[model samples]
Target: MTLLDNLLFSLSTTLPILLWLAGGHALKRTNRLSDAFIHDANRLVFTWCLPTLLFLNTARSSIVDSWQGDLIGYAAIFTLASIIVLWLITPLFTTDRSRRGVFVQGAYRGNMGIIGLAMVVNAFGTEVIPLASLYLAFITLIYNLAAIVVLQAGQTRLSPLKLVSQLFRNPLIIGVLLGLLWSITGWDLPGLANSTLQGLADLTLPVALICVGASLQFQSLRNNRYLVMIASGFKLIVIPVLAVGIAYLLGFRAEALGILFLMMASPTAAASFVMARAMTPWGELAAEIIVVTTFFSLLTTTLGLFMLRSLGWV
Candidate 1:
């Protein structure tokens, strides 16, 4: 595909997400979605809908068939590295402990399951979906665990036992674990159960995006604009460049390399805002970063893809 094609593809995947966000904002402006509604909706998305989505994705994928240890390993390592780097450096951006955690989470978490998978399939075709699915499954777990750690650390330190308990108790973590178990055991859900899960899974993205839109406060953006830029810079530019560059050096190429770049380059996960709002007082910071990176990722993702394609790296 030409650079123009890639650019258009990137825009196509992200534009609707932006529109969903805008739709929510419009509802808020018109008094259609109130604060209470948004809050309750976010809780619903995070607690049940998102977990169901995760469970279904992982359960449906044949992890054994699509297993790529090196690819998954690189993704997990770089994800943890990005989190550590951001956790250490985010204090430079703000002294507010909660805001620091939100920054770190925003800077590192990508919307891999949604935007990342869409671009991956478009670039490489359905042949790569299983690999992509496995990647999503493993990385989803990492993102949730790391997000909880950093977000909680911002509030106060906890014992290792307490942290582990917190992580396992999380619905997202449980969803991923149960899904992986189902995948491994080759258990098939009955038709009715499958349909029910599918219905809830389908609700995750749209609801999450709308909640993100409604929660976006101009005052928060105005107050935290600088921090938003910093988080966006890491998420959309620095992290992708560094992660993909390292993968190229490490001898990854073609679809493997392409997937790495696209996943890292996608944008901040909308779930970041939900998790933030649920756990911390800094959901606004997470929402701002998501909005900013998501908007600019259209250009950033295309340019990155074009460069890799031009250089014959992917």
Candidate 2:
């Protein structure tokens, strides 16, 4: 298939899920569902469904021959570069120590776990699965470090070592580590084991998207509109432009270029709120950015695919 055809197919596949999320928001607005219901859905998806999906997707892939160290290096450098940019820009936007962490987190982090991996898998193939796994690992590391620094920026009592320890205990990080070890060791799952994992993994995306829809509060957007827009702009526009330029300068081509663009273009991660809630006082702001950016990302991602194709990078 041509790049435009592939882009259309991918967009079609993604649209239904986006619509489902929008419908959930509509339902919540009409008071058809309670906040508690949305909260529980978010909990179920994050703590159970998403991790299962990540683990099964990573574990089932043939990683012995497919693990690309160079791709991992590119992803790592891209993540670090983005974090540095965020650090420089964060102070300009917020002086509230409590709010700085969320602002910076939303600015720098992309939804690599959900949207990023899905796009890579859709645009490239299972062969890119190891690359996605490696990307997730590096992204997680950078995000955690950035989160800690941002959260503790003005606090004399905060210890970086303590923050690092807390991050290591995060469920998503644990899932990634387990998946990586299983991938590197080439461990085979029996049929039953694989089936159970695949079943759980399959539920992750749809459930997570639905939960995202249900949890979105339009009211919060009204309060933090400027921050949300700025963060989203950085995520969908500036980050991808920088990443693509850097990827080209560094000699990445084809699928690697496509993957890098997709990663950089993804909406803010669903976990950003969780991290903000746990580590900062601006959890509500983080959620607002996630909801707003997710809505806007449909257009940006489509345009990104078209541009990449026209430029013959994909």
Q: Which digits, one per residue and each the tens of the lDDT, describe model 1 over residues 1-314?
A: 99889988988999999999999888998899889999899999989999999999899899879999999999999999889888888778898886788899999899999999999999999999999999999999999999999999999899999999999999999999999999999888889999999999899889999888888899889999999998899999999999999998999999999999999998999989989999998887888899999999999999999999999998
* Off by more than 4 A, model 1: none
What does candidate 2's lDDT look like per residue over 150-234, in tens digits? 7666343557678678667766666666776787787787899888778877776665666557666677778778788888888
Worst 10 residues of 1 by lDDT: 90-99
Instruction: Count clashes in each candidate, considering only residues at least 3 apart in sequence or on different chains.
Output: 0, 1
Q: Candidate 2, which segments miss by more than 4 Å at Cα? A: 1-7, 144-157, 277-281
Give me the candidate number with maximum lDDT: 1
What lDDT would each prediction earn against the true structure? 0.92, 0.72
Taking all chains together, the TM-score of candidate 1 against the true structure is 0.98
